[model samples]
Each structure stands twice: as C-alpha cells, then as structure tokens.
Target: MMNRHQLPDTLLMGYAAGALPEAFNVVIATHVSLSDEARARLAAFEAVGGAVLDDDAAEMAEDSFDRMMARLDMLPQANARVTEAAEGIFPAPLADYVHRDGRSIRWRSIGAGVKQAILRTDGRASVRLLRIPAGQAVPDHGHRGTELTLVLQGAFFDGNKRYGRGDIEVANEETEHTPIAEAGEDCICLAATDAPLRFKSLIPRLAQPFFRI
Candidate 1:
C-alpha cells in the first residue's frame, strides 16, 4: 500500500491516463507493481479513462485508449514474475529516451555522495540524471533559474516533505533547501534546470565549476 503522503492524486491520475513522461511513468509502473492497492487504484483510473472515451459529446481527437488497453492487457499476471520483471527493468527505463539519438548524457561526479549525468542541454537549461546514496546530504542550494525534479527511485527528505518515487517537485531560483537521502536506499532523481545551481556553502562553491550537475 502507498503511504498516506506517498504519491499525490494528481500524479496517480496522470499515470493512469498515460499523460506522464516515459521516465516518470516507469516509476509509477514500478510502484503499482509493488502494491496491489495502488494497482487497484490505477484500475479505477483506467475506468475513468474508459468513461472519457465513452463521452460522445466531447468529440476529442484520437485518445489512443484502445492502444493503451492493449498494452495493459499484455502485462504479466503472475505476481512473482511481475515483481521480478519490474525490478529488472527499473534501472534502464530511459533506454528508449536515450536512444532517440539527439540527446546524450555526460556523467560527472561533484561530491562524495553524488554523481550526475547531464542528459541534455539546450545551451541555457539542462536536464540531469542524479544519484545520491543513502543518508547522504545534497548541498544546500538554490537555482539561478527553475529546477524541476522527478524522483525515479527511493526517497529523500527535505524540510518536512518526503518525496518518493513518481513525485514531481518544482523548485525555482527562490527555493533554497538541502535534502538528505533516506537511510535504506539511494535516491535517484531526474532533474531539469534552466540555469546553473547556486551553491550555498564553501564546499559546493569550490566544487561547482568542477561539478557537472
């Protein structure tokens, strides 16, 4: 079961409606793989989707609900096998995203606790793939522009908020906070930023130029 604050209803609805990015969808898929209650909720979301498809008055464009249903039907049924398969596929969910050929990631280590892969850059803003080990602290920093983070695996705590898989966090230049990874698992996140991160301390300041994230 998902904890009370685990995944927001908006994200769950997006996942069920097939409206999320592929990377974030993979995380929601993994969560549903782990929880029967969440899976049932997803099923409810699909039912709502069916209702949308049945709405004749809307006259929307092709929603591809049938295609999505076909894919859902193909998903494995055995519980053990489903869990194993989802776990196996977790690490490489971005395979298709990376293979599109136009985008690439440049991995660089910024601190003892973190390593980052610069996934794409438009000269101004950039996207990154980041991993911070269990119990490690991400530097207290703010952004020069906007920063949007999607949690792909594990959990992290910042201030009073605890973000888990499939959560999308939007932070801006005005948001300055430090986060610590939970004790049991590493925190892996996809971060998109429009400008350089502003380091808050001497350590990050010294490492900023050499850091890739």
Candidate 2:
C-alpha cells in the first residue's frame, strides 16, 4: 500500500521523453500505474516537453486542436500510452507483453524456489519477471550495469532495506547484495538490466550464460 522507493526525476524524465530503452520503459510504465506520485511527476514532465515543443513550433493553425484530436483517435490505444491501468497483477502496459494470468506464463526455474519469465524486448536491455518464494533468498550478486527492479507483489529485503509493492529499487555497478522475499506471500518483480549480473556463487556464475540473468 505504501512505496518507500520511486524512480528519480531524471529517469522519469527519460521515460516521458521516450528516451529510455523498451525494457526500462516497461518497468516505469508498470510502476507509474501503481504510484500516484510517479503519475503526477510523469504528467509534469510531459507537460514541460509539450510546452517546449509548442514554443519551438510555428504558429498553430485554426484547426490544430481538432486535427490533433483526430490523430489521437486514429492511433491505437497502446500507442497513445498516456497511462497504465491495473488489469491483474500485471498492469495494462505489461499485460500487452504477456498473459495477465500467472499460470499461463512460461516461467523457467532458476533455483532455490526462484522462477523467471523473460520478456521480449529490443535488446537495449533485458526485461524479466522474477518470482521468489517467500523466505527464499536470491544469490548474492553485483551489478555490472544498471538494474531497475519494480516490485509488483509482496516484498523483498536486501541487507540494507526493504522494497515492497510499488517500490522500485535502482542499483548500479557499485551495488551488491542478496535479496530475500518476505514471509507469507511470494515476491514478484519486474526487472530490467542493461548488463548481466556478477554472481558471487560458483554455481550461479556457471549458469548465468544459460539463464541470461
């Protein structure tokens, strides 16, 4: 019900400007759906972008408003992408990529009661949904690049802090930790990483290439 972490303004601005990679975009879009603060910030960023564009453009024609409305109407709902509505555990934007029903998803077991479903993306980054059984701990790992993880259900705690539903944890090359899910319910996260993780465990290191985690 409450979020302790959210995307920074720079990242939200990148999302508003459509400058983020598709994998990251999915995480933002899904997070925005769950966060009112993020939604408001995104709207503010979009408004600034719109104002900038308007100031640079030539004088508006008399029918510009109508024309724009018509264009928007002609576009697909997904293309407009103004907001992500809650559908199931997956928000509207994420639902477009995979089945809302968890049972239908093709999840691959990673290890230690952890499973993942990799989502197809443009390859600028990798996107995956991670499901960790309650009380299970993911192996200790360090990031080689940026990692964005948005909790969709339940919660997880690194040694330092806990991230619950609607909270997004941003980690970079300098970060390293082991995340364990809270008791009672499984933790589901939408995660995007620009580079492969550096697992400390020998077994996970050997399996990294095969799982692409």
What are the clash counts of all predictions, listed in order?
0, 0
lDDT of each: 0.68, 0.88
Q: Tell how far residue 211 is off in model 2, in angstroms.
A: 0.8
Tens-place lDDT per residue, model 2, 1-213, is 122497888889999999989999999988998899999999999998999888865768999999998898677655666655756688888887776455478999987779999998899999999999998999998998888999999999987689988899988887877889999999999999999988998988898999999
Q: TM-scores, in order shown?
A: 0.55, 0.84
Clashing pairs in 1: none
Per-residue lDDT of 1-213 in model 1, one digit per residue for the tens? 123334566667987897765445644554565557767888888999999888867544686776787899788776544222323324344433343475555556787669887653334456667889998989888877656676777888887788887665667766887878888988987776667788877887887777654
For candidate 1, give the lDDT of residue 185.
Answer: 87
What are the per-model C-alpha RMSD values against the true structure? 8.2, 4.8
